[model samples]
Target chain A: SAVISQKPSRDICQRGTSLTIQCQVDSQVTMMFWYRQQPGQSLTLIATANQGSEATYESGFVIDKFPISRPNLTFSTLTVSNMSPEDSSIYLCSVGQGTEKLFFGSGTQLSVL
Target chain B: AQTVTQSQPEMSVQEAETVTLSCTYDTSESDYYLFWYKQPPSRQMILVIRQEAYKQQNATENRFSVNFQKAAKSFSLKISDSQLGDAAMYFCAYRRVNSGYALNFGKGTSLLVTP
Candidate 1:
């Protein structure tokens, strides 16, 4: 198991602005993923952040809207660009290391006004 | 594409009682994995249990256990002796074995526990 922490547990943002959420893991991990959970909906994968390369965005997601940076095995960041009311949701980061289990962060609640 | 389904939108259980949450998935692959995750009011997703498709026996974790029906493509979670902390949204997820693909999650079931 890994201890994951995210910055800005909850925040209110203005439309058209961008907010960057940071994810830091206690141990090194090979794969880190970002997900978005809309109100009353299931979680959707946003992107996968791997060190030393560009992040892989899912089919319905684009890097321009959710840019990710993975400088090392233990740290990653995701930025939500051009925030809108529709972007009001919970953004969670998860890490999969040597085991098949995945551990998640508490998530950052973002509300775009 | 793999899809997971949780039909029960909401359920309630009395304290010290047991409840089961149903989950079904559609997948063409023979080898895959299933998981149950719990999200409380704090919005922290925690792993409750996991089951591998190839495994014949069900997965169990203390008070939480899974009745895995591979032939039916169903994996259900049974919580025994429910507590207030057990009240939350429970999600079922599926992942491809040996693939680095992300998990496919179902719309969660909100469980309310009354003392």
Candidate 2:
């Protein structure tokens, strides 16, 4: 088990403003994953962040909108740029021990106004 | 492509009674991992149980267990002695062992526990 912490448990921001969510892990991990959970919907992968490299975005997602920064193995940040009402959702960060298991953070709930 | 299906949108179970949530999946890969995750109103995804494709025996975690059929591509979760804490949305997930990067999740089934 890993202790993952995420900041800004929740926030209400005006449209067009950007909000950056931070995720910190107790231990160093090779890869950290970000996911979004829309209202009444299942979780969707946003990107995979690796230290010293650009984040890999999943389908239907792009870096221009959700920029990720992984300065080191223990810290990563995701900025939701040019926010819109549709961007309102819960963002979560997870770290994997192996391909089989992933431990998740508490998640940050964002509501764009 | 691998897809996970949870047909039941909502289910209710009496407290202390046994309840089973159905889950089926389609995958071309031979080895993969199946999981049952519980998401309460808090929105934190918690792992309940997991089953390896190669394992013959079912996986059990305390009062939670799984009935896994590899050939049938079915993995159902059984929660015995259901409690109020069990009332939440249950998600079924699939991940290819050593191949896939993220967990592919189902639409989820909301469980309601009644006293």
RMSD list, candidates in order: 0.8, 1.2
Runs in model 1 deviating more than 4 A are: none
Estimate, for each residue in A1-113, the C-alpha lDDT of model 2 and write its tens digit.
77899998999999999999999999998779999988878888899997899998889999999999999999999999999999999999988875467888989999999
Lowest lDDT block of 10, candidate 2 chain B: B95-104
Using TM-score, give the best candidate's number: 1
Per-residue lDDT, model 1, residue A84, is: 93
TM-scores of the candidates are: 0.98, 0.96
Native interface contact recovery, all models: 0.74, 0.39
Question: For residues B5-110, could you state the per-residue lDDT of candidate 1 as single tens digits?
Answer: 9999999999999999999999999999999999999999999999889999999999999999998999999999999999999999999987674899999999
Q: Indicate the TM-score of model 1.
A: 0.98
The alpha-carbon deviation from the true structure for residue B63 of candidate 1, after best TM-score superposition, in angstroms, is 0.9
Candidate 1 chain B, poorest ten consecutive residues by summed lDDT: B96-105
Output the lDDT of residue B100, model 1. Answer: 79
